[model samples]
Target chain A: MIELKNVTKQYPGQPHPAVDSLTLTVPEGEICVLVGPSGCGKSTTLRMINRMIEPSAGSITINGQSVMNNDPDHLRMGIGYVIQQIGLLPHRTIAENIAIVPRLYKWPKEKIVRRVDELLVMMGLDPEKTRSKYPSQLSGGQMQRVGVARAMAVDPPIMLMDEPFGAVDPIARTHLQDEFLRLQKEIRKTIVFVTHDINEAIKMGDKIAIFGEGKLVQFGTPEEVLTNPANEFVENFIGYDRIVKKLFLYQVQEAYRPAVCRLRPEEIGNALSKMLAEKAEVAFVLNEADKPCGYLTREELEQEETARDADGLQKLAARRSKAFVQTTTPLPDALSVMLEYDAEYVGVLKNGLLEGVMSFKDIRRHVYRREGE
Target chain B: MKMSWERFQIALFEKAPEAVLTHLLIVVITVALAILISVPLGVLLTRPRYRKFGVVALNILNILNAIPGMAVIALALPILGLGIKPAVVALLFQSLLPIVRNTIAGLLEVSADVKEAAAGMGMNQRQILLEVEMPLAMPIILSGIRTSTVYVVSVGTLAALIGAGGLGNMIIGGLALFMPEYLIVGAGLGAIMSIFFDRALSYLEYKITPPGVRAN
Candidate 1:
């Protein structure tokens, strides 16, 4: 747990601290988003933790140990950081960029190389394609991936990302945000993410801390922050669309299976028959034991048949080729996957096995429930 | 007896195929040396605690820069004793201020946000300086170097007054000898090098320096 006990920061001759005696704690394994308008001290509050900006008053403790007592270098090595511009070293290759923290900690050369390669792949980059490429050659979205890769290089327990997705275009930004959320699930790192976007805060934050003019105006879950705004500033910051925003959060879950659907070789015929009988046109193909397989349409089978020799067609066998989700995956993500694959449903899996299927129909039903409440 | 201006002029151009090369060499050497020395100093001076001291140092350097070239050469004559060293020393000192001052201005011109982004990414001070700050400051530094080069070319003519050999010695020779061609060659070469050099350095500066590091 990271705790900031009434931390404050005042520039010399300033009338008030940029962060004013604000107190907060971010529990382990949670995403705590700090957000506010420009100059509200959210950024200052974030920077103060790393001692990039010193707090004028109050104390900061990481897992109950005072950060002030430790060398700032040691304190920073254990924390991951990402920034708005994605702060990549322009001259360095993606691998070397991610290796910075490990190199700083004097990790062995082979270990640094191994860690860099693993993180590159974990951040969804192909090490072969990206490892040697300099920062300038990558797009905004790719740069953010490298930044996230760099942050995760040392496997720090805490990650600090300051508007990491802000530089990318909207489509890329949304995609990156989803990828970031996915990474958080896999890593389960305690994250302190700062942003000014309410939608992002609602989507990613387990807890939201809203700031107003150097003071923390509200601190609560997204539901509480949006539905029960602490004051006029927070209400205004959250805007009048709080109802719709809240609805989007829970509505996606309703649209379908938030679990992985997989089909094995033996179940392929049965799954295909179900789609044909229901006239669903497209069905998710789950493997025999039930896991996410790719979407299949009768048209795909016909195309394959026409392309093959008659003898080959007679010998053709059915197999489930795709696996998709784990339960607890966000609705927005699952829905997008369904939409992208042009399927009516997706498979939900828990652990390595398939649990159930979620259809668009099921998702609508969930949305209806949220609306009624 | 004093040597005739004709022979004095020969010492100036002794190594030159044409007398003009003596003046060209003096101007070129002075500007090059100034650039080599001042840009780093200028960049170093703009740092936090050093800013005020940097400004004051620049002011003093500028005062030195403004001293009459002939007077500088004359002042150096006693210690440097009537040769290329005194002439080159005077011109180099005079050329330093503009290049150094402009280098500082250029470096300070980089956006603060860019610097902060570099720092927050776990870059130590040296990394930020060598990687981000210096690259951004290069264009401005080059401009300073160019400005000083042009100034030093014009000042090289004054070196001849103190018996420090250069094309200026030929101009002085002609003035004493009433030989118009020698004066024309010396003065013409100095003027030509000044214009040619400013353009050349400006071109090199533009061609080589990148717009900026992608802090975005």
Candidate 2:
């Protein structure tokens, strides 16, 4: 855990403090995002934790010891730092860059090499191809990966990131964010991430600290901040589209209605009867193992001349081409899939078993109810 | 008198071998002194506090460059009067501008991102300078050194004016006596020496450049 108590930073000639009596605590193995507009001291607060910018007053501790007592270099080595422009050493090979902290600590040559290769593999790059290449030789996204790999070289428990994904294009930025999120799931380092993009904070942060004019205005989980903003500043900063943004915080299973009126493949007459009795437009068709097969709709049942026809139900039932979303998939993504496929309903599967179903109406109702609350 | 290839060969290989040695020695010492003085001075000039001083110092060196080589030798003659000593000092001064200027330029040109990275990774000030800044600045520094090497070799010929021995002695004698063989021997050997050193340093520059930074 990293904790800052009443931290303040004032530049020599500036009229006002850059960061003022800021206090924050990042729990072990959780990401705390520091977010605000430009000149809000978000970057200043991050730099102080690593002693890149020394605080004018206040105490910063990692785990339990005050950082002021530790040597700056020693403190920094144990805390991984990444910046907006990834600063990979151009003169060094990728392997050498990743091995910097290890070499500084004088790890065995074989061990450093092993660690470097392991990190390369973990970052999803081909180790053999990338080990010898230099920073300039790699693409921007690859360089950013190498930057993160280098920071993780020592496996420092605390990682300080200052808009690390800000330099990449939108598509590459999203890829990097996803890759880092996956990496963090396994490593679970205490991370203090700084970003101006509120949406990124929502996506990546377990807790968000909102800064305004060098003072932290509010700090809470993404849902708490979005649903119950601290004040007018946060509400405006989160913007008018916050309702839609809140959807990203929810998963498909969280709001999905469990599958009902399900029928076996051979129960065509029962499927039609269930649809009529439930006053539902469609009934789910399930195979013998109880997995979703397709949907038998009222329109399809009426279009068919008779339920007893040999291939009647099979021919009338819509193909099982409706998109399948995992239960863990976020609602916004699930919603997009619905729109993209022109789907009225999507199957939500958990471990290959149809746990529930989601439709546009259900999503709208859930979102409206949440907003009302 | 007509030029004779045999006499020229004799002058180059046997008769004036010491003069050739003296020419090579002068070029070596002068270039070495230039490197020793200018490289550190260049690095110091790059420091933020000293940057303004660097501009003033470079301006003075630029003024010195504008002066003719013979005039510098003549100016040195009054203070240190004669022989290889005065000529060496003059050539050393003459080579300073390129080496010092280029060194400062090279160090300044290193990307700020690379330096910030080195610091962020926990490298101390000295380590960042020696390990990161120096290696990145090397190719440009080497190019500067190459320029100085060529200048030193060609300019060493002027040493003969101060009663210093080199191929210049033969050229001066050949001109006085109207002997084309002596002029051909001296000019030919000097040209070869300059080209040889320039090419060798150019190759060194290519070798020392970091592979990642290579334009290719």
Candidate 3:
């Protein structure tokens, strides 16, 4: 959805252009990352997308329209922008921070509130718990999440995040990346992310753009770039231990869940019988959103079958995390996600529909493929 | 020559106090005015369009600072005349060099990561200046202020020669009087004022400069 044609950026008195004559295209709904050492102009290229820095030469188009003629204010509104410092306007509250772009675009108050609430839930944050806090009051992770929330606030089709998680500590950074990857699956915005850290670029990006000395070294999917680099710079840029890096992408992110024959608030007896007949260990108790509010394990069902008040059974319906993902996410990211929440799996929400499993079998296939490749 | 206790106390209070107070006022005003002009000027000097002129302006200010205070007063007498105005002008001239020079250095030294973050937000030059650069520059610039204030306070006594009536007047008067006490009072007060400005500015230095910006 975003395309660059022969872009070049030359700072005055500099020996060479910061972004050399370049042409590239970032496909719709993909996470494209630009990465290089300092002064290589990976950042310049990313900035050029939003016109944060005007290209010295060539053309850039978003959604098939050239950015040169496009009004920057309007163009920026259509593309989300994030920064390393999590620039949430320290003066503003979290809710206000998330509401900035929408307010700028004249989105109605009701719509803004609705969008905020929805994002807060999807990002796994309690809006009531954290929405009123300022950026300074938040933990580094919380502030980073708020930054993403603010970027996603307007539901822009394209997002430009320049090392968005760079300022946070490593543990927080990993968690933020996982949460963002999950969020991206649901929102599907075309994103151009920038970072100097190669591991981060490989971990979070669908495709990676490598740079050296203000020139494009290579642009390709992680596997292609790792396996067959475009040039010597690209190969060196990928660095050694690349095979180890490639193996991280094989995550057991998706899985087919047990058929969820759930019980209504009133039908405890029937639900218990179904659980016993199926020899099921657990089953979901869904709420209005068709989301699991809680789970009923076999032990609880058995106890209810003996001498239980329906009320007691409902009490035992604990919010256990049985909801899990489909096989879309690469294994390493999926493993990272599982590691994040201390969960074995996460429910992959895509296209507003539940997809089947991402399990060890899927990851094993990739690992086995690695042995051959 | 044994000194009486009562006589010494009276001498200390009467002769020493005026010089100290006058010295304090001269130094304070000079440094304050220097900060007022230089901080803003220094900030302006570092802008991209003005950067090339930075070396030029800095050289001129350094030369101005190098001139002796008495020479500055002598030069100013025709244009500014004999008064506290010349004292202030001299102190102001001495005070500005460090404030501007340090400000430019401090502002330019901000990390590229932080600068890039500011630029990515779609904030224009003014926003970056006030919000990002200035706040970060406060500490280093304050050090310059501290250095200049100490220097300005030391030179403030020079105002006495031009009849500007600072602590310098007491020393100069004491010198003429051949009353050693008067000389002690003037010289002692100048030293005290210098120490005070240095300590106060250092305290402010701690408060304004964020941790990790510099070494202690």
Candidate 4:
């Protein structure tokens, strides 16, 4: 665990301390998000942990050892740090940028190359295509991915990200956030994420630490902060859309009702019986690989034309299932897909197979009930 | 007395060779000295501790740069007396401005975001400067070096006034005796030398620039 005890940072010639006796603990493998408006000292607190900004008073310890005890550079190397600017070295190619820390630690050449390509692949970048390209050649999203890959080069247990997704457009930002959350599931690094966006905090943070005017207003799980805000400042900071924001806290996996039956395209007769027997409006169509290709509604199946050709059902379902989301996707994302397709229910997939479906009605009940609590 | 092809050929092949060699030597030494002194000084001035002094240093270089070359050569004669050494010293002063100014500007021009990322990634100050800052600043720095080299070659002709015995010697002699052949020979070789250095360094600058930076 990383713990800060009464940590304070006071700058000279400044009337108020940047951080005032702030104390918090980030349990191992949890993402603790520090969020507040500009100049609130959330970024200051993060810098202190890495010794980028030293505390004027109090102590910071990682697993019981004071950060002051170790060499600053040595301490930093073991902690991964990413910034909003996506600071990949412009002069270095993607491979060399990722290899920086490994080379510094004196890892063997072959091992570093292997690790570089492995990281590129892990970031969902084509290793062969992206490895030799420079930062300028890649798009903003790709550069951000490379930045994260560079930080994780040493596989540091703790990653510090300062608005890491803040620079990209909203669409790319969401994609990056989802990809990172999925990666975190496997790595489970203790992460301190700083941002000004409440929805991002809710989506990415395991524990949200809210700050106001250089003081931490509240620190708890996203649900706790949303339900039981410590004071007026936090309540206002979370804004008037707290109900909609709460949708971000729950995943599709949690809120989705499991599908009653999923049938292959060739199972026309079976699909008809399943829809009628369950009295469901829609039934998901799965391909040979068991992946949801699309859905056939009761109206469409009843038309008789769609069911006549077994091969025609496959051709009809070729729209690529726009109204589908992975099980880990946040409810708000699922809602977006539903709205985008103008559908009431969104298909939730687990490992590309149809696991269930979540409807707009389901999210209302889930979020409203949680809001009441 | 008259403009003769035979006299021009003699100036080109026989007397011109020694003057060209001397001119090349003075330009080479002066440019080398300017680079050696200016590059490190420029880097030092850009350091956080020394950044405050950067303006003062640049202003001083700017002042030295404003001085006329011949006047500088003449001013050097009173202090160090007349010779190739004094000529070189004067040319060296004239050359320092471009290199030092460009080095500082180039290093400063490196993106702050890139530097912050380097530090955040655990690179020490030295590593950041050598690995990140220098390579990025190289194209600008080389352009500065290129400017200084060409400037030094053109100005080395003035060193002949201090008895440096360069292409300037031939030009001065031709001017006094009114020999157009000597004038053309000296001026042509000097212009050729300047253009050659400029083109060669431009090529080097292009070759060394990172592809990412080049794209920009």
> lDDT score, residue B176, model 1?
93
TM-scores for chain B, listed for all candidates: 0.84, 0.96, 0.90, 0.97
List the candidate 2 regions with Cα displacement exceeding 4 Å: A276-281, A288-290, A297-316, A368-373
In terms of DockQ, the best-performing candidate is 2
Candidate 2 lDDT over residue span A1-373, tens digit each? 9899999999999999999999999999999999999999999999888888899999999998999998888888888888888888788899999998898888999999999999999998999999999988998889888999999999999999999999888999999999899889999999999999999999999999999999999999998899899999999999999889999989887788885667677776566677888877766767779877666657767676666452656554445545668989989989888887666777788898777778888889988888777
Looking at candidate 2 chain A, the ten consecutive residues that score lowest on lDDT are: A308-317
Q: What is the DockQ of each candidate?
A: 0.20, 0.74, 0.13, 0.63
lDDT of 1 by residue, B79-177 (tens): 788777778888888889888888888778776755765565566777677777787777778888888777777777778777766667777887897
How does chain A of every candidate compare to the true chain A by TM-score?
0.72, 0.91, 0.70, 0.80
lDDT of 4 by residue, A1-373 (tens): 8999999999999999999999899999999999999999999999999999989999999989999999988899999999999778888999999999898899999999999999999999999999999888999999999999999999999999999999999999989998999999999999999999988998899999998878888999999999888988888999998877887788887788885467765685466678888888778878777778777667766786645466666555545377799888878888889888777777788887788878788888888788787
**Candidate 4 has what TM-score?**
0.87
Q: Across residues B33-137, which tens digit of lDDT does each residue of candidate 4 receive?
A: 999999999999999899999999889988999999889998998898888999999999879989888899999999998898788878899999999999999
Clashes of 1: 25
lDDT of model 1 at position A368: 57
Model 2 captures what fraction of native contacts? Answer: 0.65
lDDT (tens digit, per residue) of candidate 2 on B158-207? 78888777888988888988977788888888999999999999999999
Candidates 1 and 4: which is better by TM-score?
Answer: 4
Task: Show where candidate 4 strays beyond 4 Å.
Answer: A252-330, A333-365
Quote model 1's TM-score for chain B.
0.84
Model 4 chain A poorest 10 in a row by lDDT: A311-320
The candidate maximizing TM-score is: 2
